[model samples]
Target: MVATEVGDKRVDYIPGNSSIRLVDFPLKDASFRSRRLLQLALATIPWAEKSQYLLFPSIYELEPQAIDVLRQELSIPIYTIGPTIPYLSHNQVVSTNHDYINWLDNQPLGSVLYVSQGSFLSVSSEQIDEIANGLRESGVRFLWVMRGESSNWKNICGDKGFVLPWCDQLKVLMHSAIGGFWSHCGWNSTREGLFCGVPFLTFPIMMDQPLNSKYIVEDWKVGWRVEKEVKETVLIRRDEIARLVRRFMDLDDYEVKEMRKRARELQQVCQSSIASGGSSENNMEEFLGHILHGAKP
Candidate 1:
């Protein structure tokens, strides 16, 4: 779970640690050579040349300790201010006949489930089938948004599962009918879902997803995670998936009551953060001020 970033090295306009960041993807093998090269390059960038830093850190920094480690590691000024989501909240249930909206209204509240595999992280046909069977067995109506070209979903399912390429995820989450999300635990999606008050059925596919999943079920008290990776097979367990879904979706009145409470708190956070005078809102004002004044920071 403690893996590094993926892909080849790329350049970004940070102040420090900005000297040719090498992306040893999956971080599986940092390749001594690549690491040495990175170190050498970093060494070349004069410390005085570095002044400001901007970074989008993981939501794991929601913990105080994680925040401290980042502060320690990056001596130069850096902003670990993220899980930064674009949020929109409404108290009034306005009706716009977006087809999805009508369908959403008709379904039972806290019943129709949502399944979205992030833009990355595709599975095999077998894996898709396993997911389909698991959802079917769980007896939950769902909307599964699958990505990629060769999912090979012949007879895969959309009867009870309204399969779509993509939808307004935030809108879907806010719908009265949506109960739980079956997700790959992408931080952005996770943030939106949390703000919308939907508990998650988390299946972390890669990178910091496992960490994100941990934050949700363990730290945030928002959702449950399915154990990924297997002893014998590469495929996720159909039964395990079903069990997790059922566990997460078991809407006892008390639990639902608490979840609704959680949702409202999250909504408050988003509302204030985006409103004209709130944290992110104010931060944006200062940011533009700097830009207009010419990157003073």
Candidate 2:
């Protein structure tokens, strides 16, 4: 199923133009309850085909092969104007001093790990406990963004880390004190991590997350997987998590140094794509030109 082609291989979609793995496809396994939502999401494909234009919130440089292939296969005009994150907000000054920012500022450069599992579809309490305990044991300085009951976070994280309900995710990732990211591999988080040039510790949950993790760990070689296999039944213990976190945070590690290097390279690519006359900029201009000039369908 992983190697099975879904359509013509005339265009290079996946790396080497290989067939998308069954596991890599979004919503690979849909339960009866989720089937309706899955159908609704899938319905967009045909709808896009009938439209005059299609806009992707992604950078052409990031997925050149996929974007190029889609333009070749599809009849309508397609534009990649992305990294559409709240980058503009970064310049604005906050009225109040955030404790998290102060904490990050005090930490040594690239000495902290930033952890967030995403706002939706969180892991089980058991998994959460394991992760929290593991970070405590790892002896690494970390900033974990978690929602809900925070009463026991101090005990769980010990003195090595800070836990909060939320923070400016992109801002946190871009901080000089942040060394690495422990992420759920959501596309938005993944993009932010790449943009900030931070290596990842992928703990993907579902849907596009697993595929994003694959790209981070395998294709990009900028990160490592926290879970060898993503299964609810498989609980990664505290000791293992501690060990992985330790190795990941070790900046002196030769492998880690290389991974960080690759991450920076990708970050440069992301930056260039958004700069003047960049791929993303050009695409945005073209898209607006079409609209302003009232180009025919």
Candidate 3:
């Protein structure tokens, strides 16, 4: 979906390149070493042909142009049954002790920011300190989703922000007080953000995150990416983090206003696509019919 320089292959993903990646499925050539896994995948290549079709949780509204390109190139029938979040009953999956909805109630409309890295991908201690301090300095009311307790946050996050081990992210995103998202740009999280019409303050960690960030900032014009220097090592200073956070949180900025407008428009489209008689809903119904009965979709 990113409008980066095109190569001869005419496909977004390069088989061996680390540039296009998912967290767990490290491609054949990545910066990190995993020779054994690569060998195992190579061994399994011949057996992969037995699979019938590739199912994706990607709705057409988000990337109709890209999906059109994919449909023309691929042999298999691809079903875009997505924005799958609404189908999930959070109560059935897990329960939370905290009432974030009440917390959100106290804040002004579109005033707070939500910060989270998904369940996987660990941020270093130093990076955590930087992020916490940056948010603190930004003076923005934020709810940070952290998996475990950390001593560094005790002094850093005062009354300005609330920290939770885990929460129903979709519920939090849907709240009225949420103005922006500081996300790792995981695909699911990306969809949720879009569905809620919240603009992003992207802090991509690894894998598809970079590409997701590219799409958010460049393709969609719904967010800004935090700057980082990558040579022998990746470095993002606390000052830069603070700067980006403050800029994104500034409600008066014209650019930020435009982003919010675009996000809201996209959010409506996404919600409509999953509703009754919507494109994604119809597609999902057809897919199930094809599976459960011998019906053509």
Candidate 4:
């Protein structure tokens, strides 16, 4: 199917959306098991149609074309009430002072790189080792959120950065010290990164990640890909990783400056969407009104 759609390097089109390409489809190169899972998940689409309303946890401005297409195709009223990642909670003060928050407090503005792969899947041990050594070699300040084996990573990373099992990811992204995000391109992570206005170093692992990476690098133009190719067997060496990290963190570079500008622009858009009289706010109010009245549109 991929071959038929992407024949001879020609541009491939998605089924309904013309602005997005088939090559950027989430299931383009999915494994057999992943494909089966996707097939099973698709069964919910018809089920959704049976309902009176369909609500998407996504910002309408970010995907206007796709949202419009869905509204046209679906019979029920569709609402986009998104940026639903608990970003507003950043305003709530917590009583406890965590070590990571204190660590971020001391760092220079736009100097630290925040690294996190998704919780569902991760890169190989060898790749992790390379990333650890590379970050140390780059001489850049980083705060990495890892799940396991913190002691070993600390030994590899030395004193240049902090590696913890977990942190308040949205809070970390909102920190003034955070310069860029090294991510696995999970949908939630992607949304948070965009909301925070942070440039990205995309290292997608599987599932919808590659497509998210494409949007970050190609469509959004706010990030660069850490791995140039999609081949799992090919390892990105430590030296190359160091070079990329160093360049990505360099604030003086003209290209990096432009990317940062774009990132800030996107952040403004996200903030506006959730504000009063904004697109998301209006949609949410409409949805609430419908529910309260128990009336069909």
Candidate 5:
């Protein structure tokens, strides 16, 4: 799938059009955007023009309307064989440190909030400080995966929350204790959260993150956005963060319960999509059959 930022206007690819430009996303430096656009133009233009099929790590169950729209617009077969992480995992067990897993085991189910902004994107130190304080003030049981430069989560949240340099995100999201996620709304994270039935305190930073956030909050009805306006100059206040966290994690709140209900429903849909004879599984088989039979480009 073409991974462009989504917003008020949907970005579309016109087949055979050479003037398609990568849409602008938040927090990118001017020079960086120029270079990235150039790189994408070089890499995707020809590929998009010629590729026979486009495979998205998505399932129609999650976005039937969107998939329907795409099918109508696109000229080629666009397969939705996703929650793709599981198939890609190949059932290879990854070894993880036992300490965090053990800690999660001790906490009550739906008690902990997992916070991570993914590996590549880094926020400003001021924003980081706000997030740390927000987590602390929320008074929620949390596990934050920090980057090497942002190792101060321990100091920020103290012993109230667990701070790790890195851990298996899939493992953490699936843990019984994790009730909510404070995330950048990256597609992988979004899908994982959906798979786990965990609602989000969305803090989208860049690229597809915003689009995924929109889908989570608006389309899916499973999460809430931390900041309405995501800009480099805008810093999310700690109070808003704390408020959103409480709203998402508070099991008693009617809205929170509704979000959880929707998330769990979506989680089941995601699971069923990948199960034997399910939509994604069937699609995968069809995709393979097409390849084996040498479908035309």
Candidate 6:
């Protein structure tokens, strides 16, 4: 249900599939931003109406409260599917014996961490250096992607890590050597870890990252957040960073194994869903089945 809180509006087009993405909304804030977004969505609603499918990755997105408001107040037909990353991995990423891939191959299983912030977020030189220093001091083998910040972090313990400008993220995570992910907990990355059976060393940045982190650290029991800062001045002590990284890497009990098993099961289910007769497959089919089922366009 959309929040009656916002005066009918649409705000943003969330990324991921057109189908799933509701659990990520910070609803109270979006209500305030809805008016102009309402204008934006209205300008496109006519075009959207002509289209056969109604997909909103995050229903809570773009004043979905308003969309629910409008849908309930009027009668609009919009259908939703779920956490779409699992269903979207038909694309294969091959990581062969490139020097980087080869380097990654040499690390011990459950011994290396994969750290990145996707392409959209950038860390300051200090933060990058701090992390690099931490990883180096931890004596960990890592495949870190620090794109567009060559000068920011190149000098800090360069050889102990493979600091690529970017790498095939999916391929890196799927590697057996990757024990955990040091991530921003973006939905795609969070879901990627879930899919690959790699746990997380979460350093959530903004928006849904914090919420996704909660599921990882608290609900799932598979990950932990690195640090909490009031505004921006948080020192990254090399020892503490190493300690948490070790915690995520440490698979001491049946607990880690159980979580890994669950992740694998979900991965299988997710893979199955995108195939014929699976939930995502069926969901897509049913949506297509109704194209001319006498509903008003």
| Candidate that would win on TM-score | 4
What global local distance difference test value does model 1 have? 0.63
Clashes in model 4: which pairs? none
Tens digits of per-residue lDDT, candidate 3, 199-265, equal 9988776566767776788678899877543222445678778888888888999999999999999
- Could you tell me how far off, in angstroms, the CA of residue 140 lies in candidate 3 after the best superposition? 1.0
lDDT at position 275, candidate 6? 61
- lDDT, model 5: 0.77
Q: How close is each model in CA RMSD to the real structure?
A: 7.9, 4.1, 5.6, 2.8, 5.6, 8.2
lDDT of 2 by residue, 1-297 (tens): 222243112223554333344555655545663466567778877888789889888888777777888988888888887877766333342322789888887899899999999998688899999999999999999999988876568777998799998898888887888999999999999999998899999988767787788778877889999986534355899999999999999989999999999999998888888889988889888889888999874
TM-score for all predictions? 0.70, 0.89, 0.80, 0.90, 0.83, 0.68
Worst 10 residues of 4 by lDDT: 1-10
lDDT of each: 0.63, 0.82, 0.74, 0.84, 0.77, 0.63
Give a tens-digit lDDT track for model 1, residues 1-297: 122332223445533222222321223224575456556756866752465654443332245455555567666544434447654444433365566666777788788888887886565668877888888777778877776542444246545667667677877887788888888887788878876778777776555565577667755667765654322234676897777676566777576457556756765665566566665556566666676888757
The digit string of per-residue lDDT tens for model 4 on 170-267 reads 88898888999999999899999999999999998756787788789987899999976544255889999999999999999999999999999999
User: Model 6 clash tally?
Assistant: 9
Lowest lDDT 10-mer window, candidate 5?
A: 16-25
List ranges where model 4 is wrong by over 4 Å: 1-11, 15-24, 28-33, 88-96
Q: For candidate 6, which ten residues in a row score worst on lDDT?
A: 15-24
Once model 2 is optimally superposed onto the true structure by TM-score, how far is the C-alpha of residue 110 displaced, in angstroms?
0.7
Better of 5 and 6 by lDDT: 5
Better of 1 and 3 by TM-score: 3
Candidate 4 TM-score versus the reference: 0.90
State in Å the error of residue 291, model 4. Answer: 0.6
* Stronger candidate by TM-score (2 vs 3): 2
